[model samples]
Target chain A: MGTWVQTMLVIMLIHLTAGTPVWAVLGQAKASVEKDRAAMGGQVQSKLAPGYSVETITVVGMTIKEYVSLDGTVFAVTWKGTGVPNLRLLFDAYFDEYLDALTELQNKKPRLRRPLMLKTENLVIERSGHARNMWGRAFIPSHLPAMVSPKDIQ
Target chain B: MAYRAVVIACLWFVSACGSSGGGNGSAGPQPPNVLTVTVGGSSVCRIVNQLCTQVTICQPGTSTCQTISDILVDTGSIGVRIFGSVLSIPLQQEVESPGHPIGECVSFIDGSALWGSVQLADVVLAGEPAVTVPIHVIAPTFAGQSPSQNPCNSVVDSDPRTAGFNGILGIGLFTHDCGISCEINDNNNLYFSCVASTCGSIAAPLPTQVQNPVWLLPSDNNGVILTLPNVPAMGAPVLSGSVILGIGTASNNSPPPGISTFTTDQNGFLTTIYNGTTFAQSIIDTGSNGYFFPDSTLPLCPMPDQDFYCPSAAADLSAAIFGVNAGRATVPFQVANTANLLQTGNAVFNNLGGPSSSFDWGLPFFLGRVVFVGIEGQLSTLGTGPLYAF
Candidate 1:
């Protein structure tokens, strides 16, 4: 579909679910992709591949992409651009788990200022970039489509 | 009385002429535009290949200056950010209203951030005239709120020891850190106005934003030339270089002949084609410790340091770099086993590399080469920047 039409549909969907709580994309339903865009206040563009679909949102200097499986579950999300997107909204229920792992990693390696590669039991988060240009991806191993690989998220 | 007069005369002569031109025959004064940069070597910065320098911060309009060392020299970012713990003198905080002070959250590619308040100060770089500009003071507890509580939720360094450097001096290719984006978008998430303990994102005008100290220089304000000596494959424990302010504006900073200049996009990004894939978000940053790019063929290190590559032997690699102006250059680089290099106890390496999402020519790329960073919208002999010439 056209981008303008997709954006309008996203906006209308957001308006319909205006009073609902903010939706997180990772491991959530595909419908939450529009809610994530609304929470970010960005424009949305959708594209379909073989077994999954990608929803991209552009806000300010950042771009976020949400990958949804054929079963309508968000399996992974990738972000790139100036600053990071709101991970609290994107990671949804998994935000605290990610934070705990990150804190543990920081405590272990106090002085290393390199790219982050955090892997928990079920969730994997990797970020790399510098100031003004940052990018990263978060995904769930079990939630990925059968035909999809982690490398395909980007 | 005569003995006293003799003693007084001797003291006068010694005080007036004892040390003038007596130290070394060929040693002359250093150029005002040159800032000596060091990697490791007695500096408290312990990270491998981390570039360090010193900057003088003074209270605005006053000579109450404090010079802090171990400040990271980062060409990947913009603006001067100092740790508040090392600052002795107080600086005027930038505010949007009577009760609200401006706080900033600068996130890095490493998934870490520096949270602090913006304050105006007289920044002295090398021997240049002090320029009063806004700078980020690294204070995670600014206004009694932590980074997690603030809008930007990321891993924030609380002190210099954990951060590996005293602060960062971002002499990149821009005038302001956020530039026009923060000036227009209130939800930019970089700048915020804090009241008591509550802070909300606010649109910060250009004048109030933290600025690149090099841009405010009276002359030599165009850009900087960072030159580091080449390191051997075995690496070195310490290395030294120079960051010459301005481009072609001084006798010391003139671009050498037979140089390649490539213009970047507005966001300071060039394109890199590696392994038959075109990565458009490539960047040259001294802040990154080593070359970070994606290559599935290279094996990764074991746990704890798995973020770095652990190849069996030294792997030779090459990539083609493309600028927005259709300028292209082919560059060859090497990636060695990180475990072997780290065990050598060397702080500087030209072959250390790791895995990353984009093609980042980190400090290793600056070695044995004189790279010039032309600031955006600034004119120089290399043409108007944002361009990188080497």
Candidate 2:
């Protein structure tokens, strides 16, 4: 059927270096060869074609269950890198342990307040080593990539 | 020492459990080594699916950043959904298992089921960094229900500007949601089962739905490479680029220019042919915004439900290059016409994910374009295999 759909994606990199769990991949790529300088820090000097500076990392001490966060851009900045973000964070952590009693009746019902008001922020990104830290995730682990074990899977 | 024992096991690990990130990246024989990160967007027109164009994101805590306009940058379902009950950062859903509440019963292509929840945030993507991952919050909606179920009822269709798109950023490669088959095959599959009462267990599929997060990237997990700007007369304007992450990491990502690399069979699905229709599978999702298939006949776009349209009509969108045997040259688009070409309906306007058979080119086919998805078993000196290209 297309090779049986390619045999379900033919696994085994140790299934990802022995099936993940190294510090959860915290970071490693900065070997000091130093060579990422695009004229060192944008803005004071203008347009060499500048456009696309997005960054939203937050997985260290997670907190964003259930769903619905509107107003606009509901989805699609998706530059690439899948696992759909980690299957949407394992379905938002199994829907935050199963929607805690229907959002706790919208958080203990005050006539179900209106106009959307949720404030539980904690998305501090900047890690690498495969991302599993949370000292506020400042992680500059060197932009990740260097754990290739699994008898070297190639 | 082991990188300081993973920062002392990230403070006794267990924390970052699931808010987002992971759908399929990291299984191997080869494949991994990709990092192309590109951002800076605009294309506005959304009036409930009339001309859509967006990519703004700012809700880390919000002072106002919502514009996720004509999104579709999916890698096949993982996270980053949006539709609202009230927002800026008010979207919630929770419940992975305490009683199973994150609620919702997904399975679109317009068959209808996309309930909601399994959400969590901190996913800012532009040049790579903002990472809290776990996303899904899709929203055809629910709040007492009534996001309105109209096949063409409201007209622009799924509404969000005629589904021209405002949402869909499934950065492929794998990490969560059905990847080991929802954690080791259940076969009932709602991703393993979930229907209502906040949703949970009722499915029984082998691969009916749940398949994109872009092959799963720890670095180009495998298969992608869009690249556009050809214009061909504004026919490809949904443009943008830089999802180069992994597929053996660089040498220009190797394998290109005609499409057909084929590997995924065990559930990653990739049967090939597209545009002329041969189909066995087709999930390279960036969260599907186009290239869906099903049919009543052909020349699609007409809805009430059921129409991948391939009676043979085909016209409106049609292309098929895909390279694997020789390596690289993707194209793989369709439904420009020819019935049943890319099936699925309920008319979110179009593209729900093809009639059971599979053909999800989503990510607005990678707007502005510059695609190169590879990672599934990497090699890359320009060989081995995975796909997508410009």
Candidate 3:
């Protein structure tokens, strides 16, 4: 199965079980703003760009912004909040790959203790925060639409 | 044990010298069981605020021993971990399952982890000898032997160049590195048993876990005392000290009357209240170069230096350290602009700090102070184990 199909299946499963369409952070189908507004229990707003649309959701004590391609795919996710959201829940199936990449990053810089920035063939992640205040951004490099830069994910 | 304790106590008064100067070059009745700690000595890699000591290792129990210098003395962690590339002599590898060697993935608060194998070696610290204890041998090859499913297999230091030090001597406030967590849980992922080329995550029994060689000592095993000379307000190129093994067991390491003792929880964490915010999981980590604490008032250095705080002026801050009990201490610390400090090419700074989740009283906090690390489940004159006393 294609990566999108597998991710779509996982999203469908989560929606079916939880009665809410949960969008994966980096690689799910573009979210239905109405469903997201209800599922997250917060306000949902969006802005359409030339090639992609940016949807912002404020909920769970964290503000998350998702970059959606015109064809309907969440290519990136950025979040800022008091505490880091569980990556397993945020990235879904892609969490394992993120972890693998993180390990490789540590191997390269064994003494790097702060300001984590990771870039892999498939993903890009940056995390920096202090106590009770955490923020980060993660994006699927291949899924990012044309004219949309990874820098825009932030 | 009681008879030995009695003998040591009697010798403390008879053999103890009254010299106040305890620098690395102290000429006053140097004990045979002692090691000199150079804060910023002849280490090839000049990482700032590092407390380093010399260690002698041998193949289990042989005449062959190599005294390796530049071993970082860390009170924040437990056990001895040496890079495989630095080892001149080979040690016997320990196995968990039949014909399967034990591997470990050690994680730090910084989100960095090390993948390595556990080997049995006779580790000599200062003049104390610990026979047949499990130690970590960091190597990228061993990481491949571990199961792919294992979380630690994902992270492996490619070479010793990135490791900074020859090895790390973790004589923290614990007996074992992973302790009961890895002992009872099979999925802890810290420990693994490799059969042939396939390694699987398994529960590492307490006896098989990487141990604190200090705890395995024949005498003076209660704890350790680290005394580093005072660095100037600006910074210093080099500083020196002594990492005396065993607390109260040795005359040179006994805590003075009214010595402040702050206890820590299972993970070696205490509480620190600074700037009206209470950081519940504060740790005194000598492994960390600077005093890492979160303070919004202090400006963060731009981009690459963002990990450290960059104040217009060196900010002198105070925090109250609260123990598990009612024990409390108010400590005054400083955080200087790391970028400007780096310009001077100084390796030891008294006012260096960084940004971290919780309060990390790092190596800078150890300067000019005699710090005692009380090991868990052990007894010292300061009361019980698992306490940081100054």
Q: Which candidate number would show the highest lDDT if scored against the true structure? A: 1
Per-model fnat list: 0.49, 0.00, 0.07
Residue ranges of candidate 3 with Cα displaced over 4 Å: A1-154, B1-29, B143-153
Candidate 1: segments with Cα more than 4 A from true spot: A1-21, A108-111, B1-28
Q: Indicate whether candidate 1 or candidate 3 has the larger DockQ.
A: 1
What does DockQ come to for candidate 2? 0.01
In lDDT terms, how accurate is model 3? 0.70
Model 2's CAPRI class is incorrect
Model-by-model DockQ, in order: 0.49, 0.01, 0.09
User: Model 1's A-chain: what TM-score?
Assistant: 0.88
- Per-residue lDDT tens digits for candidate 1, residues B93-163, read 99996758999988887767889999998887776777899999999899887756666777688888878
Which of 1 and 2 is ahead in TM-score? 1
Deviation in Å, model 2, residue B10 alpha carbon? 53
Q: lDDT ranking from best to worst?
A: 1, 3, 2
lDDT of 3 by residue, A1-154 (tens): 3764455456555666887455355677664433444444555667888899888877544577778898888888776643344355567668778777776655442143444556666787776432223457888889978888865666
Candidates 1 and 3 compared by TM-score, better number = 1
CAPRI band for model 3: incorrect
Q: What are the Cα lDDT values of the candidates?
A: 0.82, 0.32, 0.70
What value does the lDDT take at residue B317 in candidate 1?
96
| Complex DockQ, candidate 3 | 0.09
lDDT of 2 by residue, B14-83 (tens): 1121112211112221222322222222322221112221233333333223334345444544445554
